[model samples]
Target: MLFAPLSELYGRTRIYHIANVGFIAFLIGCALAPTLNALIIFRFLSGVFGSCPVTNGGGSISDMIIQQHRGAAMAGFSIGPLLGPIIGPVVGGIVAERLSWRWVFWVLVILSSLLSLVFLAFSRETYAPVLLQRKTDRLRRENINNNINNNAAALLRSKLDAGLTPRELFLRAILRPFKLLVFSPICAICNVFVGIAYGYLYIMFTSITPLFEQQYGFDGVRAGLAFLGLGVGSMLGVAYFSSASDRYIKKKAKEAGDLAADDDDGDGEEGMVRRRPSVGAIKPEYRLPPLRLGAVLLPVGLFIYGWTAQYKVHWIVPIIGTTIMGSLQLYLVDTFTIYAASALAANSVVRSLLGAVLPLAGGPMYEKLGLGWGNSLLAFIAVALIPVPWLFMRYGEFLRKRFAIENL
Candidate 1:
């Protein structure tokens, strides 16, 4: 909420800088927290501020990267969140065992602080509106006393003034994403599959420790290493899909005659038609292809990981299976996030709300069912949702036509 609105208001660079500083401060607060309550407070605040990257990273990518290159950029940006869970616990466990839990926060505080300073020193403003505003400011100051014609400056000034106030801007920023998520069937269905995939990922992360330590007789540090598979898989997925998505979009655009000529204004509507691939086309099914592949692999991985670990089969078997699952999971997330961003161009808020809620619910679901069964159940649900993206991708344009949301 804060990220999207602030990015539009103060610009992405400003928000990124400010949020990083807040993140460092909150980390320090967590380090020095004297009580559980204080720690929780600091952690929650850090999460609120830390959300800046998750919320605006896509928008930032969209701002600078053309549709053809956004997939790769998004994939690269997505690495942090994907790897954090795996890396955080390993480092935390080691630091806590060798030093203390306080040191964990202390270390993070120092690192985050250093990174924040670096970003502040070097990060450039990427939001076009903000950059344009800066130019407009310079122009006004230069022409304050001149009677020379300045239509461009006058028009830009009017536009800047007509821009939404901070309060109204923030309200619309927060509400619009929700409105899209609620009304856009394409967004809604894809969000469900993405949400489930994410929820299961978290569930698996929590469950892995017990499964490894108790079942395999691995110690704490060794058990933590199991997460390395997830990290590796995530990185591989990002590297592959990031570039793949961009190429796929470009290829589809060319096939659809949406590719604009060099001298053209780049305002043509050709590519939008290809955004949802035709059912009979030789083109890859952009929306559902990743989801369908992930859906099939996720359950298979779960079954293999669960039953093998349950029966004390070789550790390598489960590891291999989980690795495949992890990679596919990351791919699913990257694809859906990009898809949602594209479909709900102006409404990112709703995408994030659902993103936030699904993870919270995953814990409860896992707690009620044992790890093996819980994951298996999630996989089963994923199977049902696999076709949702396919349906949307095939019929989405028609739905959009009937609903006439473009006018809205």
Candidate 2:
């Protein structure tokens, strides 16, 4: 939350560098800590720094990818984080067999360091405003040296600079995610919906280990095999969503175009006047239908997994449930264009809060309610949130323009 907005104020590469360095430092702390308290603190700090990539990735995609291709690009980017929880246990199980718990952090530290080096060597600044700022500087120097004043860059420079002090600009930058959360109905509600989705995901992940161990009598490296279902499910979700997402959006866009063409006379049934799209050429709401399908299926998946796990039914059934849930996520980036990073940051703030705290309830909740009822509770909440996607797809464009974030 605090750091994500700085990328827009500074540059994506600079923020990446900061996050990479901090991630390595705190991860090393986690690796070296002798006490559990110290380890927890270091882990917390590491997570704060580690989130930069996911938060800023949407912004980077907005800078580089065209609208039509972003669905595929976003899916590719999304698969890593979604798979991380499911895959982490597998790697951790292997590392724990041969090495201490600290070695897990050590492994991540080594990988993060190597990735940082590559980023330092090759990653270019992708923020358009930041690039413009650089060009404006060059233009200013050239004009100063050559006695050529009032260049075209000046107008843009003025608009960007806005005579704000650095402190004011920083405040504005940091506050934007919160502003969107507070003021933008789309951001707030979508984030709440995302929070519920993420909370359930964490609940399932946390609960699965013990459930598998108790029900299947799995232990040692074999226990890690339980998470294989989640991994397979994540991959399946990735493939299905990536291939179908763009196709669905294009279909919506074509339908919209046809409607506009038919509305050439600006008539509606009886005396009702049709509300033409007031946002961009392709409404962002076009991206909502698939997400709606995902949302509806998510609860259904949880119900299946919960009952199957409770009954100690065939192991594959719960896995199929996770597959459904995984497909339902990757929600934020698909919704916004320019402020994708801020949008994601807003979603992440709520998501991380629920993700962290909700799982604390998992052990107790499961103990009391048992697997079936506990999961049913979560599923029930999800079912209630099903209306979010439907309403957003219906009226999101109106809300987006009504609460548009201007000139930040």
Candidate 3:
């Protein structure tokens, strides 16, 4: 959340560079820590600083890509975060077994440094306001240098940006997400939904070591390889959603084309038609899986994965279940494209907290309730919330208009 707002308030590139440096420094701190306490502290700091890219990434994408084409862009961008888990387990297992546990931090440090260098060479500030602020600064410099006292554009920009103090901007960056989360039902529900899915994924991560190692008696390397099913599932989810979202939007646009007059700046989901846009707007529900596919598939996936793992069914069966549940929260970006940073940051808080805390309960829950019942409990939660997206589909605009955050 801090980084998300900071990127918009300051320059996105500057925030990334600072966060990268902080992340690397903390990783090095972890690699050389003298005690477990120190290591834990360093690890926490590393996560805090390292997450800057993800927090700001949605907003940057919003700045660069129109909503019409963002789904495809997000698919390519999401591959890293979604598929990243597959790499983490394998890399950590190999590095710890071959070298030492501390070497894991060293490996991350090296990779992060390389990424930082790449960003330094290529990454540019993508936020529009910050770019304009830079232009304003240049105009100020030029006006002063040339003694131009009555530059209309410069005066207007200065007046427009007049109360934008650093402290005020910082507060906006930090507080806006919370405001959206608290005041906007759409934002809140979406975050909670995404958070649960994210937490479920982490819970699966915690389960993998024990579930595969003990149940199947897999060797260490093979246990790490257990995550491959999920990796494949994640990729499948991304591919299907990307294609489905684009197809759905295009179809909706074709049907709504009569309402569109030129519609040059019309972003499909935002306002696809200029004439009577409210009636022709592509609803957020259009981004959802048609016929409640995601709603049913999520719980179904949990049931299959749980029961299969419970009864020692064929590994492939569980993999197939995982494939069904691996799909997750991409539509929120489309739902609030201009405020994508605040929107994603809202999820960041819920998802990060849930992702961290839920896994801690995984071991005890699985031990007490066993895999089948434990997963059934989660599936029950999913089933209960099935109406969330549907409700939005039917009444999202009314709710959005009625509870508009700025009004509050």
Best by lDDT: 2
By lDDT rank, best first, the candidates go 2, 3, 1
Which sections of candidate 2 miss by over 4 Å?
Answer: 139-150, 156-163, 254-279, 331-341, 403-408
lDDT of 2 by residue, 223-243 (tens): 666777767766666666666
All candidates: CA RMSD (Å): 5.4, 4.3, 4.7
lDDT of 1 by residue, 362-392 (tens): 5576568755676678668767765665676
Summarize candidate 3's per-residue lDDT along 1-408 as a digit string, tens digits: 678767767878999999999999999999999999999999899989988877777777777976556676776677777677766897799889999999998998889999899999999888766787787677777766544533644554564454667787777767877888888887788777777877888888888777877777777777787777778766776667678776887677666665655567646655554553342365555666532667677889899989998998876787677767775433323333322334776777888889889999988999999989999999999899788767877887788779877621
| Full-model lDDT for every candidate | 0.71, 0.77, 0.75
Predicted structure 3, TM vs. truth? 0.88
lDDT of 3: 0.75
Quote the positional error of residue 265 for candidate 3 in Å.
24
Deviation from native of the Cα of residue 58 in model 1, angstroms: 0.9
Please provide the root mean square deviation of candidate 2 (C-alpha atoms, Å). Answer: 4.3
